[model samples]
Target: MIRGIRGASTIAYDNPELVMQETKNLMERIIRDNEVLPENVASVIISTTADIVSAFPAKAVRSLPKWEYVPVMCTHEMNVPNGLPLCIRVLVHVNTTVPQNEIKHIYLNEAVKLRPDLTK
Candidate 1:
C-alpha cells in the first residue's frame, strides 16, 4: 500500500548548511517514527517559502546516506499573502505496510507553530 507522511520545519536563516541540517533532522524523525525504509519511499517532495531560496532542502536530504537512493524533488511554496516565512515542508509518498491512521506526521522548530497539535 502507498501511504503519505508529512513534515514541516523552519530555518533560522537562509544559510544552506542550517537549512540542510534542520531538514535532515526533520526527515530522519519522520522516517524513523514511521518505521519507513529508504527502499519503501517512492518519492519525497519538499517546498520552501518564497523567502528561502538559498538551497533546495531536498539536496541536503539526498546527501544523507539513508536517503541517497530515495527520489527527491524541491519547489517553492505557494506565495500566499501573509504566509509563514522561511519554512520548509515535505510530503513523502511511501510504499508501506502500515495503515494511514498509523502514520506519524512531524512539525518542528518555528514550523511547529503552524500545527501545534501535531508536535510532541
Candidate 2:
C-alpha cells in the first residue's frame, strides 16, 4: 500500500544557503524517522511559505544522494494571516507495508507548532 508522510521545517532567514540546508535537514528527518527508502518513494510535494523565495526546496532534495530520480515538486504555500513564516512543508508518498497509524511525521524548528500533536 501507499502512504503519505508529512514534515515541516523553518529557516531563520531567506538566504539561499539556509533554505537549501534546512530543506535537506527536514527531508533527511522525514526519511530517517519513517525508515523510507528512496526507491519506495512515489513522489514528494514540497511547499514553502510566501516569504521563502530564495530557492526551491526541491533543488536541495535533488542534490541528495540517491534522490536524483525521485519525482519531486515545489510550490508556494497559501498565505494566511499569522501563519508560520519561513516554513517549508512536505508530503511524501511511499510504498510501504507499515500501517498508516505507524508512519512517522517530522516537524522541526518553529514549524513544530504547526502540528503540536504530531511533534515529539
Candidate 3:
C-alpha cells in the first residue's frame, strides 16, 4: 500500500540557509516518526508560503544519499489572508505496509498550530 507522511515547519528567516535547514529538520522528524526509508519513498512534494522565495525546499533533501533517486517537487503555497509565514510543508508518498491510522504526521514550530490534534 501507499501512504503519505505529512510534515510542516516554520523558517526563522527568508534565506536559503534557513529554508534548507528547517526543511531538513521537518523531513528528518517525519522519517523518524514514520519509520520511513528513502528507498521506499515514491515522491516528495513540498510547498512554501508565497513569502518564501529563497530556494526550493526540495534542495535540502537532495543532499541525502538515499534521496538522490527520489522524485521531489517544490511549489508555492496559496497566499491566504493571515496564513502562516515562512512555512514549509511536505507530503512524502511512500510504499509501505503501515496502516493509515498508524501513520505519523509532524508539525513543528509555529506550524504546530496548523494541526494541534497531531502535535505530540
Candidate 4:
C-alpha cells in the first residue's frame, strides 16, 4: 500500500538557507519517525506560503544522500487571507505496508499550528 506522510515547518526568514534547512530538517524527521527508506519514497510534494519565494524547497530533498532520485515538485500553497506565513508543507507519498493510522505526521515551529491535533 502507498501512504502519504504529511509534515510542515515554518521558516524564521525568507532566505534560501532557512528554507532548505528547515525543509531538510522536516524531511529527516519524517524518515526517522516513520522508519522509511529513501528507496521506498515515491514522490515528494512541497508547498510554501505566498510570502516564501527565496528558494525551492525541493532542492533540499535532492541534497540528501540517497534522495537525489526521488521525484519532487514545489509550488505555492493556496493564498488564503488568513493563511499562515513563512510556512513550508510537504506531502511525501511512499510505498509502505504500514496502516494509515500507524503513520506519524510531523509539524514544526509555527507550522505546528496548522495541525494542532497531531502534536504530542
Candidate 5:
C-alpha cells in the first residue's frame, strides 16, 4: 500500500545552504521517525512560500545521499492572503505496509508554531 507522510519547516533566510541544511534535517527526521526507508519513498513534493523564490526547497533535499534515488519536485504554495511566510512544506509518498495512523509527520523551526499540537 502507498502511505503518505507530511512535514513542514521554515527557513530563517533564503540562503541556499541554510535551506539545504534545514530541509535535510527535516526530511531525515521524518524518514527516521516514520520508519520509512529512502528506497521505499516513491516521491517527494515540496512547496515554498512566494517569499522564498530564491531557491527551490526540493533542491535542498535532492542533494542528500539518502534521497539520491527518490524523485523530488518543488513548487510555490498557493498565495492565500495572510499565509505564513518563508515556509517550506513537504509531502512524502512511500510504498509501505504500515498503517496510515502509524505514520509520523514533522513540523520544525518557526513552522512548529504553526502546528504546536502536532509537534507535541
Candidate 6:
C-alpha cells in the first residue's frame, strides 16, 4: 500500500540556511517516526508560503543521505490574505503497510498550530 504523510514547519525569516535546516528537520522526523525508507518513497511535494524565496526546500530533501533518488518538487503555497507566513509544507508519498491512522504527520515550530487536532 501507498500513503502520503504530511508535514509542515516554519522559519523566523526567509533565509536559505533556515529553509534548509527546518525542511531537513521536518523530513527527518517524518522518516524516523514512520520508519520509512528512501527506496520506498514515490515522490515528495513541498510548498512554502509566498513570503519565502530564499531557497527551495526540495534541495534539503535531496541532501539527505540515501535519499538522493527520491523525486521531489517545490512550489509556493497559495496566498491567502490572513494565511500563515514563512511556513513550509510537505506531502511525502511512500510505499508502506502501516494503516492511515497510524501514520505520523509532523508539524514543527509555528506550523504546529495549523493542525492542532493531530497533535498528541
List model 5 lDDT by residue over 14-116, tens digit each: 8777778888889889978988777888899998888886767787777777777789999899999988888889999999988887778899988887778
Q: Which stretch of 10 consecutive residues in model 6 shows the poorest summed lDDT? A: 111-120
Global CA lDDT computed for model 6: 0.95
Q: Write the per-residue lDDT of candidate 1 for residues 9-112, one digit (tens) a residue.
A: 98887988888998999998997899878888899999999888787888877887777889899999999998888899999999988888778999998888
CA RMSD (A), model 2: 0.7
User: Ranking by TM-score, best first?
Assistant: 6, 4, 2, 3, 1, 5
Query: For model 3, how does the per-residue alpha-carbon lDDT over 1-120 read when each residue is reduced to its tens digit?
Result: 889889999988899999989998998888888888998999999999998997988989888668888999999999999999999999999999999888999999999999999898
Instruction: Report clash pairs, candidate 2.
Output: none
Can you rank all candidates by lDDT, best first?
6, 4, 2, 3, 1, 5
**lDDT at position 109, candidate 4:** 97
Q: Give the RMSD in angstroms, all C-alphas superposed, for model 3.
A: 0.8
Model 5 residue runs over 4 Å out of place are none
Put down candidate 4 lDDT per residue, 1-120, tens digits, no spaces: 889999999998899999999999999999999998989999999999999999999999999999999999999999999889999999999999999998999999998899999987
After TM-score superposition, what is the CA distance of residue 116 in candidate 4 from its true location, in Å? 0.9
RMSD of each: 1.2, 0.7, 0.8, 0.6, 1.4, 0.6
Model 3 misplaced stretches (Cα beyond 4 Å) = none
| Position 55, candidate 5: lDDT | 69
- The TM-score of predicted model 2 comes to 0.97
Clashing pairs in 6: none
- Candidate 2 lDDT over 1-120, as tens digits, reads 999999999999898999999999999988888888999999999999999998989999999899999999999999999999999999999999999989899999999899999987
**What are the per-model numbers of colliding residue pairs?**
0, 0, 0, 0, 0, 0
Over 1-120, each residue of candidate 6 has an lDDT whose tens digit, in order, gives 889999999999999999999999999999999999999999999999999999989999999999989999999999999898999999999999999999999999999899999865
Any idea what lDDT model 1 has? 0.88
Each candidate structure's TM-score, on Cα atoms with residue i matched to residue i, is: 0.93, 0.97, 0.97, 0.98, 0.91, 0.98
Where does model 4 exceed 4 Å of error? none
